[model samples]
Target chain A: MNIRQKVSLLLILLSIMLALLPLTANRSFSEKPSKLLAEVLGADVSVTVDEVAEFIVREDPDVRLIDLRPADVFIKEAIPGAVNVPYSEFIRSDPDTWISNREVRTIFYSTGNSEADYALVYARGMGYNNCYIMAGGITEWVRTVLDTKFSGGRITARENALFETRRRAGEMYTEYSSLPDSLKAKFLESKKFSAKKLDGGCE
Target chain B: MKFLRQYPFVLIVFLLMVVLVLFRSFGGNNFRYDAARWAESSVKGSNLLTVDQLSAMTGAVLVLNLGDEADLPGQLRPKTVIMRPESITGKENLRLIRKHRGPVILFSDDASTSARVWMILSEMGMRDVYILRDPGAVAE
Candidate 1:
């Protein structure tokens, strides 16, 4: 066989092999298993409920809280400023659509920790290193941040600051959660529209 | 020989592609199941098995305890292997999991840990793997 003929045959063989492989063209983990595991199990992968409260009070633009609960439950109540990305939808759909900005820190929280932890692993496995979990989910938030009370005779400056943040955050949560369904729907719609505008998308 | 001499660049590129394909084919790091499939099973709650359900099963079940020894129940002690969540992807651990014939169950005191470990194992293409759910735990 001619050299040209051999090269052509090799090219055709490689193409055929590539075509036959069960390639997951979308939604497969890109990170090495060990590395992703290490990151997920690391100490820095979770933030305390107090820290999330502080974020809410300060209106931190760099942080995005994701509520991984059912849509109806989210509409009833959620952490102030948290956007609902139901766990099932988050897993089924392309995560890039929900967690588009790599610069922002995305924190996942469910009613408990299971869904959030799953999301953290899935996102990090897909090469989104900016993901984290709110340690002890919304249940913990309700326990620590929402029901916070002062029993001490005298409060230190640091204690005062912490309580202040929690109080403000709790107030915001109550106000948002207590809104009527129609108003809540409008608020969510407005937030969605603003988010689209920020993304440079048209109506 | 003539082709190598005449078209070194093309031959080199072809060789590089061949190496990549081989590496990917043999690489243990790649995910076996797609995200959609994992999501389907997860949403359906088919990947979770409670302790009561596990007790009823009459098969050779391999339980992987990803938490403290004290956390594991008394009945599951015989066939259980205590493993750290982070080491699950290690060469030896992967081999042990792959070699096991029966269904493999992952348990942890923290439900999140089990959930995360289950997804990782599922993505690696391991079948018949399940998370041992606590009866008291609330479903998300």
Candidate 2:
């Protein structure tokens, strides 16, 4: 073949490879669309602040709390044990690192419901069935679980249990939020800069 | 070989278009959830009413209690309509919502239930829907 023919053949091959990439190499391009509309219409996958607080308190290994806020805002104040996975970084990040396991109840939250909702849908679209959004997000968390104060004389056993949970959760939030700035900074710094170093393997 | 040389550009464009269509059909989450707009609305507190604020509002506000009737506070009974979250469907609920002239507030001992109710109402195009800040705070 002539130089022009060779060039054209190469271009055709390149085009064909590109056409097949989505089905092979770029697997994400083949994900099913989000079922959020149907899910919302049928049922909500919202987790309560109290439930999340309980998870933190119990140190539930099966539960993963993801904060979908900007790093700066997340660093300022966040539910303890929350990993900052800002919305922008979500699409680029690997799903396995945060949400591949169906057993883990991965809950997403933000300053409000929006970011969490967005992350929930994204995770659901990626086929993560255990994903949930923190209802009302941090704002509600602050107002409900953090600032909660039990009152009134009459209460049921169930109500008492709920109150006790809230009281404990509230104390946790206070203690975490009230830590000295230097200590908080050091703690945050310790958790900063995630880099998974892959060790080289030999046969 | 001759055809490839003659129509190289066309072949490339056609392949590219195929790839685009494939991605559109198979690419993740065509249902895009706009977080910015949701954040803006959430920040505005358009659909959220704290328990304290709800108590202060003096009007014929209809509080839709999603909790069991037994769990609902007696003080709220005068203006409360108890309904299960699963039962918040059909035209009957829509008519009940439409009948209320004042703001319709959703309250449940379970915050998740109330949040679901809020979402259902909002999805159904009901206006002025709000959820209580905390289910535990409903009594006060």
Candidate 3:
């Protein structure tokens, strides 16, 4: 066959193969299952609630806390600097929109441990290595950080420092949780705008 | 032969596409289920099995313990296979999971570990796999 005829035949064959294949537009886990599993199971994938509290007290700019509870629940009470990206919404949308900043350590938490762990796995499966979970979730935060007390005992310098961090973090949590709905809404809106700006969006 | 000589570029492109398609089709160890489908099932809570539900299952159930063997409940001891969460996707472990005829349940002392392991296994398209809803129940 001539060059034109041969080229046409090849093009037709390619088109047929493409048409017959069950191609999907959705993204799948790119990393091998074994490698991803090991990474997810690693100790570094989880941060204690105390560490999170310290982050809050320090106002660490490099850390981002993600609350994976419903919007209404999040509005009622959340970690001082946490942004609400409810678990349902988080899994439904592209994670990149929320965790695009690779330089920022994104920590996920829910009322309990399950959702945060699920998000960590999902994020890591999609190759977002910066993602981590707040071990024991918000429940542990309430237990250890918010409920901390001096109890009239002699404290070491290290213990005193930890108590101070927890106290400050708890106070910040209470203050943020106590804000009026209108003010809270405004604060959240501003935070969202800042996050967008950080993500390089003009809007 | 003349067509091959004149249109080598087109032939090369066609061959490359075919090889790529074949490689993607049968060679890679990528996830079988898409992210959306896995997310949907997870949201619906179909991937979780409570302790009560686990106790009710009659058939041969393979319990893959991703925690200490001592932490596993007495009832599950007979059918439990101790496994490390990190090594769950290892060749032998994966082969055993694939060969198991009954439902494979993942158990860990930490609920988060179980949850994370469950997602990884599910995305790999392993069927009839579940995570114990509360790992604490194993201690009970």
Candidate 4:
């Protein structure tokens, strides 16, 4: 075969790969995945209602709040600044439609729990970082967001614990100390690059 | 002549697999679970989208709670919901196959619900329908 044929075949294969690469891409989460994945990543994934509150208050840019419930339910009630993008829509790898700012931190949540978690997995497969799942989803959000007391529905105790942990914190920047020595240098030098959450759907 | 000269079967298999993955992901959660597990392995080392990972992502066996007709949520019509345990009678949920107007996706083990759904939709004079059976059930 000529070089042209080989090149064309190469292009065809390349295009196919590009299309399918993130077919299972996920960016955020609802449930912490199994232990093997959790240990390797060492990232705090569950987005408790209280963390949702903290994320909103501090305006953490590394976080983005996405609601994966159906449009009508989301229209009725959602986290203040959370954006509504039905989970079904993430069938494509494109995050631009759901997320306007690529680098901003994002979180996805739902009343059904795993719906947003599944969506976040698919988002990560799409090659997005800085995404997470709100652990108990909107059910927890309704408890913590409105009351600040973490009451109502089936909100989890672990969620409240995560909130308390953040509250007792000395320096948020200390999280970087856990990073490898090589990456820590870059992280410290670039103080402006620290992670923060985005608006969780406010009017 | 040119088609035969293409860079072997491995490349074709790769391309075909990618398309099927796209189709399955969009279709529903009936596949790709085991494959996603394998792909997840060495995730820190190399993030390759392999066939095993695709299977894991696709192999989703979901059991939706159709509940009883009386308990159906919201403005949804009676015929629209798959099967309601209360509305269905008898022990054979297979009856749901008779009542449903559209394709009946069965997630429940309740036989009475199945039979009732079947009868109602059939009485409504609907066909061209199908039943998405539970993965556990023996094929009829």
TM-score of every candidate relative to the true structure: 0.84, 0.55, 0.86, 0.37
What is the lDDT ranking, best to worst? 3, 1, 2, 4
Report the Cα lDDT for residue A7, model 2.
Answer: 64
Per-prediction interface RMSD? 3.5, 8.9, 2.9, 16.1
Best by TM-score: 3
Which portions of model 3 miss their true places by more than 4 Å?
A2-12, A19-24, A193-203, B1-28, B71-75
* lDDT, candidate 4, A72-144, per-residue tens: 6654555545666665554333454555467777787878454564455545533455567777776665554
Q: Whole-model Cα lDDT per candidate?
A: 0.83, 0.67, 0.84, 0.46
lDDT of 1 by residue, B1-140 (tens): 67455666556767888788776655676774466665457767799898778888887999998887755557767998999888999989999998899899988877778888888888777768998888334222
Q: Could you tell which candidate, 3 or 4, scores higher by TM-score? A: 3
Best by lDDT: 3
Identify the leading candidate in terms of DockQ: 3
Residue B26 lDDT, candidate 3, scale 0-100 = 53
Worst 10 residues of 4 chain A by lDDT: A27-36
Candidate 1: where are CA atoms >4 Å away?
A: A1-25, A193-203, B1-26, B135-140
Give RMSD to native, each candidate: 4.9, 10.8, 4.1, 17.2
Steric clash pairs (candidate 3): none
Candidate 2 residue spans exceeding 4 A from truth: A1-12, A16-31, A34-36, A40-44, A91-97, A100-103, A189-193, A199-203, B5-140
